[model samples]
Structure formats: structure tokens, C-alpha cells
Target: MKIAGRTFVVSGGASGLGQACVEEICRNGGNAAVFDLNEEKGAAVIAKLPSGAGKFFVCDVVETDSIAAAVKQTMEWVQETGKPLGGVIPAAGVGNPTTILDRNGDAFSMDTFDFVVNINLRGTIDLVRQCLVHLAKTEPVGADQERGVVIMVASVAAFDGQKGQISYAASKGAVASMTLPMTRDLARYGIRCVTIAPGIFESGMTAVMPEKLFKGLAAVMEFPRRAGQPQEFAQLVRQVIENGMLNGTVIRLDGGLRMPSKI
Candidate 1:
């Protein structure tokens, strides 16, 4: 599908990789809805875009009411701008480090594990289901017969999970595993699904890390010897939307970095 004059909803668009997507969409002549809970940050992101290029919606992915309200607002925008909902990117997630056992060998907190799974896996599914409702209503765009696209953010942990990543890996693994089946299920409606399993990238989550720890993480990269940039992620998002044949697959955005057993 063409990026210009189209609309996309980006979860977690208030910061990090999602913010980059909102910026890139506007820069490429498309409009975006910044779906996030942080009103202040979301407004800031929208403010930087061209007027009418994007808007912010207060949304919590794990809450049904929040997501429903945001979708309603987005549909209103679609009507106002006369642009079809062409894509969605689910980039909201948490990565709190946890192990199955503590120093004293006590079992890990089940609450923490549940929280991670609920936000990362269940939240992503909810957002996609809601977006698909609107996307399916729109007519297909271009000769590719594409009604919309969904790009989910998985992680390298889904494959090469290390110590303290059990919950996070399980959540991301589900996201990656659903790509092909989601594509097949949505085939009749012409909506494509793809996943991006990113490696160590410079994001809000990583920004607070100490210099020594951050450098040590980047040291494992096989080439370029640095963390991936947010723009690079956004670039791939744009490419997937433009390239119709990229459906039903997971693309690893890591720089040839196979994470070790522990951090």
C-alpha cells in the first residue's frame, strides 16, 4: 500500500521506536494516530509533525475501554481526512528483567510474569483485532489488493533469550509465532501481518542504562559495532507497507548479534 495520504495507528507512539514511526509516517506524506497513555509525550510528538499530519489519543493497550475509545477517535479522524486506515504498528511493551529464582533461590514473582505477558502479548492481539475491524471496512488500495498492514514488534529475546528473559521471551515468542497464521486468517480481507524481532536498539528503555552496561551490550554486534537506530526501525516499517509481498514473516533487525546466555 502507498504511504502517502494514508492513515496508521501506532501504539506506544509517545516515545522510542513508536515515536520514530509517527515521525516517519508524517514525513512520508501519511497521517498517524499516536495511541499511547502519556498525554504529555504524545502531544509533544504530534506537535512536531506538520499540522493535520498526526494526532494523539490516550490509549492503554491492555484496557478494553481505552482501546475502544481510541479507535473511535481514530475512525473520526479517518472520516475527516477521507483517508483509509492503511496500517497499524504495535510497539508498546515492557522488558523488566527477572529470573525464575532470586539470590536466595525463591521462586520469581508470578505477578511480574503475568504483567509482562498481558501487556506484550495479549495487548498486541487486542489492538490488532480492533484495528482490523476498521481496516476491513475500507476498500483495497493499489493493484496489490491490500486493505491494510500490521507490523508487530517482537524481540531478539524471542529467539536468543538469555538469563532473566523468560517472561519477556515467551511473550515475544507468541507474537512472532502468530505472523503466518494471522496472515492466513486475514487473507480474505487483504490485510497482511508481519513481525520485526529487533536486537539491541537505542530506545527509551535503553537510554537510562549506565554507559558501561550499554556499551557491553553493543559489544556483541558483529558489524558496525553499535546499537541500531530508531530511524532504521521506522525505515523498515515504511518498506513493509510499500512492499506487498513481505507478508507472513518475521524480519530480524539485529546487526548479526546472537545474544549470549546471560547479559
Candidate 2:
């Protein structure tokens, strides 16, 4: 799928990996509807891009109304402009520390557990459904009639979620697990689906970690000895959009760092 002049919807594009993806796509002459809850950061990201190449949509991925509205707005924008809706990048996610066993050693708060799943897992599904509806409208003018491309961001924790990461890991793991079947299901629609498992990225839960802990984490990697840059993750997103053959596989963008049984 050629990216230039294409329109891609990037959820959580206000900062971190999503923001980088929006910038990267814009650089390739693609337009992006950057979906994020942070209006200020979303505007900031939009400001950094070429005028009219991108715009920000304020949205909370967990809400059905918000997701639907964002999708409607994006589709409307494309229809008015006569641009094909490229695809969706569901990057909005949340992580909160809550042990399966609380201080009293009882079951963890179901509320907390539900929060993670709702934002990370179900949110992706919501966007996937909305994206497919739009992607189906794209008619291939040439040999490449690719309707759309969907990229899901998961964590290496899905493979080895450490202690206290039960919720976070489980949510991320759900995203990873859905890749293969999602690809198969969406394939018939001319839509490609791929999952990216980033071991230790420079954002999300890891970004706020103390320097000492971050360094200790770097030491655990098999090579590269560092957390992945958001740009690196964005680069892979670009590859998924450009390389039509890559589909239905979860690529571990981690620097060979397998997380330990903590965090």
C-alpha cells in the first residue's frame, strides 16, 4: 500500500509512538487523522506536521460514542476531500499498577482489571470494526486495490508478562493473540492486519520509570542494551503500510529484551 497522499487514522497520536507514526506518515505525503484524548498534545502534533496533511480528533477510545464519532468524522473528511481512508492505528492504551493480590492478599479490584482490558483490548477491537467499515469503501484503481492496513501495538509482556503486570500483560497479550485471526478475517476485505510487540519502549509505562530501573532493564536485553525508540516503532508502522506482503504476523520490535517477572 503506497502511503503518499493516503489517509491513515492514528489513534492516540497525541504523543509517543502514535505521534511519531503521524509524523512519519506525513513525511511520506500521507494525511493522518490523529485521534487522541489530549487536545493540547494533539494540536501540538498537528502543528509539527505539514498543513492540511493531518488534523487531530479528540477522542476517548474506550467510549463507543467517541470511537464512532471519530470514525464518522474521519470518513466524512475523506469523502469531502476525495481521499481514500488508508487504515487505522489503535495506539491508545493505559496501564495501572494493581497486584492480583492486594495488600490484604484478596482478589484484585475488578474495576482496575476491567479498565485495562477495556482500554487496550476492547478499544482496539472498536477501532478495528470502525476502520473496516471505511476501508471497504476504497476501490483499487490499479493492481493494488488494498482496502486498508491495520497495525496493533502490543507489548512483549504478552509473551512473558511479569508479576504485577497481570492486567497490563494480559491486555497486551490479548491484542497480540488477535493478530493472526484478525488478519485472516480482514484479508478477504482487502485489509491487512499486523501486530507489533515492542519489548521496552521509551513511552507508556516505561517512560516514567526511574533512571536506575530503566538502566537495569537495559542490562537485561540480549543485545542493543536499550529500550526501543518511539521512532523505531513508527518506522515499522511505515513498513507495514509500504510493504504489501507483510501481514498477519506479530513482529517483536524489542531489542531482544525479554522482560523479567516484575513490572
Candidate 3:
């Protein structure tokens, strides 16, 4: 599917990887709707793009009503503008590190586990489910008869989770696993599903890590020996959208870094 003149909704588009997707989309002649809770950051991101190339919506992925409303508003905007709904990227997530047992030997809090699953896994599922409604309505654009694409953000932790990453790993693993089934389920609609399992990316969340810890993580990379860039992630997202045959798979953007167990 060609991205030019199309519209895409990006959850968590205010910063980090999502921000990169929005910027890339706008630069390539497509418009984007940024669904994020951070109004100030979202506005700032939209301001940098051409007028009408981006819109910001205060959406909390954890809430079905919030995402539904955002989708509704986006659909209305697309209807008025005649731009087809091209894709959706669920990139909002949290990674609060917590061990199963603390130094004092206390069990992990169920609340934390629930919070991570709800936000990372459930939130992503709900957003896609809601958006698929509108995406299904779009006419196929390319010879492959593709209507839209859904790009989910998983993490390398899903495969090689470190200590204190049980909740995060489970959530991301679920996301990655869903790619194949989701593709099968949505194939009839000509909508594709794919997951991106990124390794150590220099996102806002990782920017605050101690230098020693950062260096240790970087050392694991075989080449470049550094964190992945947001633009790299965005580039893959674009490729997945344009490539008709890319579907129902998990693509790793890790630079050959396999995480070691953290004690």
C-alpha cells in the first residue's frame, strides 16, 4: 500500500518510536493522528509537521472508551478529507522493572503485573480491534488488494527477558505471538498484522539509565555497539506497510544483541 495521501493512527505518538513513525509518515506525504495522554508533547509533535498533516488526540489505550472515541473522531476526519485509513501502530507501553521476589523475599505485587498486562497487552489489542472497524471500510488500494496494516511493537525481552522483566516479557511475548493468528483472522478483510521486536533502542525511557548500565547493554551488540535509533524503527514500519507480502511475522530490530540475564 502506498503511504502517500493516506491516514494512519499511531498510539503513543507523542514521543520515542511512535514520534518517529509520525514524522516519517508526514514526511512521506501521509497524515497521522497521534493518540497519546501527553497533550503538550503531542501538540509539540504535531506542530513540527505541516499544517493538517497531523492531529493529536488525548487517548489512554488502557480504556476502551477512550480509544473508541479517538477512532470515531479520526474516522470522521478521514471522511471529511477523503483520505483512506492506511494503518495503525500500537506503540504505547511501560516497562517498570520489578523482581518476582525482592531482596526481602516478598512476592511480586499482583497489581504491578496486572498494570503491565493491561497497558501493554490488553491496551494494544483493544486499540487494534477498534481501529479495524474503520480500516475494514477502506477500499483496497494496491493490486494485492490490501486495505490496511497493523504494526505492533513488541520487544527483545519477549525472547530473552532479563531479571525483573517477567511482566514486560509476558506482555510483549503475547503481542508477538498474536501476529500470526491476527493475520489469519483479518486476512479476509485484506488487513495484515506484523510485530516488531526491537532490542536496545534509545527511547525516552532508556535515556535515564545509568551510564554503566547503558554501556553494559551496548557492549552486547556485535556491531555499532550502541542503541538503535527511532528512525530505524520507523523505516521498518514503512517497509511493512508498503510491502504486500510482509505479514504475520515478528521482525527483530536488535542489531544481533541477545540480552543477558540481569541479576
lDDT of 3 by residue, 194-250 (tens): 999998888876887667767788898888789999999999999998898999999
For model 1, the superposed segments whose C-alpha errors exceed 4 Å read none
Model 1 per-residue lDDT tens digits across residues 81-147: 9887998999998898789999999999899899999889998999999999999999887787789
lDDT of 3 at 258: 88
Total backbone clashes of model 3?
0
Candidate 3 lDDT: 0.92
Clashing pairs in 2: none
The residue-by-residue lDDT of candidate 2 on 123-143, one tens digit each, is 889988888887887885447
Q: With candidate 1 superimposed using the best TM-score fit, by how many Å does residue 201's alpha carbon deviate from the native?
A: 0.9
